[model samples]
Target chain A: MMNPISRVAKSLVLLFMFFTLHATAQKITPYLQTTSQVLELPSRVLNETRTIYIHYPKADSTNPNKTYPVLYLMDGESHFEMLSQYTDYLSRWDVNVIPQMIIVGIVNTKRTRDLTPTESIINYFGQPDTSRVSWMKPSGGNERFLQFIREELKPYVDSHYKTQPYNILAGHSFGGLASVYCLLTHPEMFQAYIAVSPSFWWDREYILKLADQKLKKGGSLNKTLFFSDASEGVSDSSTFHTNLLKFDAMLKAKTVIGLRFEYNYYPKETHMTEPMPAFYDALRFIYKAPYK
Target chain B: MMNPISRVAKSLVLLFMFFTLHATAQKITPYLQTTSQVLELPSRVLNETRTIYIHYPKADSTNPNKTYPVLYLMDGESHFEMLSQYTDYLSRWDVNVIPQMIIVGIVNTKRTRDLTPTESIINYFGQPDTSRVSWMKPSGGNERFLQFIREELKPYVDSHYKTQPYNILAGHSFGGLASVYCLLTHPEMFQAYIAVSPSFWWDREYILKLADQKLKKGGSLNKTLFFSDASEGVSDSSTFHTNLLKFDAMLKAKTVIGLRFEYNYYPKETHMTEPMPAFYDALRFIYKAPYK
Candidate 1:
């Protein structure tokens, strides 16, 4: 092995060479840079500023006027980078499985407040936690959150980015429940919806009841939906998996025209581990076609 | 829809509020940033400069002295960001499927010259392409390339990064063939190997013959290997998938002690799209364990 001193000298020489070469030759940036921008959007409805993580596709000079569909994802801090990376790779020139998408990751300040649709003291278990410092203390601001996205966030994104009219809304857990709620309540907002392990046990299945009431039989629901549940129900005593099955059954019962949907069950994966594979499957489902 | 002028005004107001809040409150950078560095290393073995993409996991203040396993991926330009993103997400606090790894993506300077093991004029078809400017003109320099990795590249990485002794070698197509060659020739270099849709039809299945000759029956070959093939053989009328099956059968017959291996075949996936799912499966296989 080379000694530490020589290594240091070598590094110095390499650095000098790099600078000189950079000055003379093309800049030595990576072949492609995944530019992730952090933006703070002022939410008029929620009365607070929301942080958004926007990941744009690499610029195509040949097709400068090309626009892309947007994937607006909830829980940005947790899964934004993953989706961004996935979108970039799957939509690459070599691997043209999916469309190139602009990923808008909505970072969360108040998870329960924004994700939950109702203010309830009930926890994951069938017990009530009425403590002031409970994690679920501030719940049920999802409607306002939706209003923020519709009235403020959507308008901002539309004006700023070269976006096609098609959009997708994706979420997991409570965020997943919020996605289902959005699909039932505001289906026109997005062309497709992905809900990975949605918490259907929220408020004793409030969303399920709403879905039952809202979705008319033989209704013209022209949209695509991808939802999933993992090993949560099998491990925990809760009926998380059962709830998803019920939702699937409800959909099968209703004859909504133009409603394309796929429900997946991953018994081997946990709620957290499910998203990696689940999200990939969802993309494949949404963009299923013959290889070009 | 909001008018352009009003949207521009809204953006200005948001930008002003962002700067003001940024100054007063805590800086709004995300909690975790998957930083990727582009490195240019002058190589003496190959007599050429090489570009390397290194992606480090988010630093942990709780464990400042944490060292990570390194995953050295071939074809860095194609899949560096994807692997970086996968590593970040799978090793997250909530997901926790795999250990956090330092990804060293070896970008290609000359694709065919470095990735192929043998100097041959045999093309993908059963015929020879002897044209002067054929893509296969610069046939093989893989041994010299391996020397660069073993002597120059590995030393540089070990000295520069905080790395554990454990390493993984991953690749696809020609890169995948290179990975298998490394595993067969230099098994001690990496603890694990992932070959996604390997181009096993290279040079009239030279690697297969080598495997048969070199790998003694019931030899003590200790390593973790994951290899797969998609629908390439069926489409191209080539023996890519058949070659993998033969290799698998050879391994099974050999009964190499301490050789942990898994073979996956994705009939639905093309050679290009196979890596996305196959890599994920390979990770799961290598890191298979009960949830902590």
Candidate 2:
């Protein structure tokens, strides 16, 4: 038998030969043509700098003037890639379930500060957290956040990219709350809204009350909204599920004209995992073709 | 009143101001630290160059020698980004459902040639196509394809990356059929297998017969296998769903020792949409903690 060092040397020679062969024949390219860019923009309304991820469809040289709709996503750090992958797959010529659109993922600096619509220190269990460094301390700057989107981010994106006037705002949990809040206050900002497991428990369901007031019976709210809740507080009789039901009932009672809405309850999934399926369903609903 | 040219000029001025302010305050960073690189390796077995997308977890300074399990994904061009997004999200510290694993997505040159096991030119309806340019022609290269993976790709990955012995092979559709075939014939190759919407009707249930023959009754076949079928033939009787049921029943009858298996039926989903949820379920099943 050969010595240990000689055997190792023989293996190295074989490995080198294999690599040499690969090097001669192999050619590699980037797997995805779709590109995402991270840009930090100064938010004059919020008095801060915000980082946003902008993912655009691969350019079509054949159609130079081709413009696409835009989707403004909250909780960019958590769900940007998921939506990007979904939109890319669904919009493929073979899978053509939805049209290709631009995605603007807004990364968070202070989650509670930017996403919450009102200033309150109330915790999830309806208890007030009096701690100095509580996450709820810097609560309620969503109005300014919306202003930043409408004035600064939107203008920049619209000016730089080929985009249609139609837009969709999507979010989850606190972001979901923000989506609902936006729909209630500035319904014209987006043509469609998707709220995945919105935290209706926030500030004693402040947004729910707001929705009750703003959405009058037979109001002309011409927009599509898709909201959902998962297994959160499922063990209890009344919780997020009930809150969603209340909201749904309110919408039904109000009979807002042209306000196309869908409510999905995923009893098996958690708040985190619900977004994977909910977002897909939301897209399909938003892009569902008109009947023959 | 301003004319069109004057309005355009004013808009340009405002845009310039916005850009100047952004340039002063903006900062940009790459969004996804978990970067994937595309590499092409020449396959001596198939006499062709194969492209593979390699996605790795971000480097952890805390544990420089940290290793990960490997997931070999077929139909790379179709589902690479989705799995990459899933693995990254699920393995996050906050959402610690599954451990982070390196994903090697093998892109197709000749898809049917590499994925199908047998050389028959049978269509989806079990009819033989005698056409010269049939996609089914130049088939039955799966064994050689497996040889390329086992001999060329896995060795390259093992040598290069910090990897654990635990590995998984995942595929969908034809790729899914390939995953099942691999699990049945070459059990030692992967510790786990995931087949999402596998095409069981391939060559009139070739793999089903193989599985029945190879998996002996009460034999020691230590592995984890998760197979699923969606709403294919839901409008009719006895199709992919029935095929899955037959496979599941065979497993039950044989009672293979050390084999952990689960079958999921997604009637609400289609062949394409099934992977989005099935993959998530598969990961959860694979990493489920023991019951109390």
List clash counts for every candidate, in order.
0, 0
Q: Per-prediction TM-score, chain A only?
A: 0.88, 0.90
Candidates' TM-scores? 0.90, 0.89
**Candidate 2: segments with Cα more than 4 A from true spot:** A1-33, A235-238, A289-292, B1-33, B235-238, B290-292
For model 1, residues A175-264, the per-residue Cα lDDT tens digits are 899999999999989999999999989888899999999999989899999999999988987888889999999999997899999999
Distance from true position, residue A7, model 2, in Å?
Answer: 14
After superposing candidate 1 on the true structure, give the runs of residues whose Cα lies further than 4 Å from its correct spot.
Answer: A1-32, A290-292, B1-19, B22-33, B290-292
Q: Distance from true position, residue B55, model 1, in Å?
A: 1.1
Q: Write the per-residue lDDT of candidate 2 for residues B1-292, one digit (tens) a residue.
A: 9999999999999999988876787666555435788988877787877889999887778889999999999999888888888888877777666788899999999989899999888887778999989978888878888989999899989987999999999999999999999998898999999999888888899999999899999899999999999888674554678888999999999999999999999987768778888988888788775311
What local lDDT does model 1 show for residue B5?
A: 100
The digit string of per-residue lDDT tens for model 2 on A86-181 reads: 898877767676888899999999889889999998888778889998979798889988999999999989998999998999999999999999
Q: How well is candidate 1 docked (DockQ)?
A: 0.28
Residue A3: error of model 2 in Å? 18
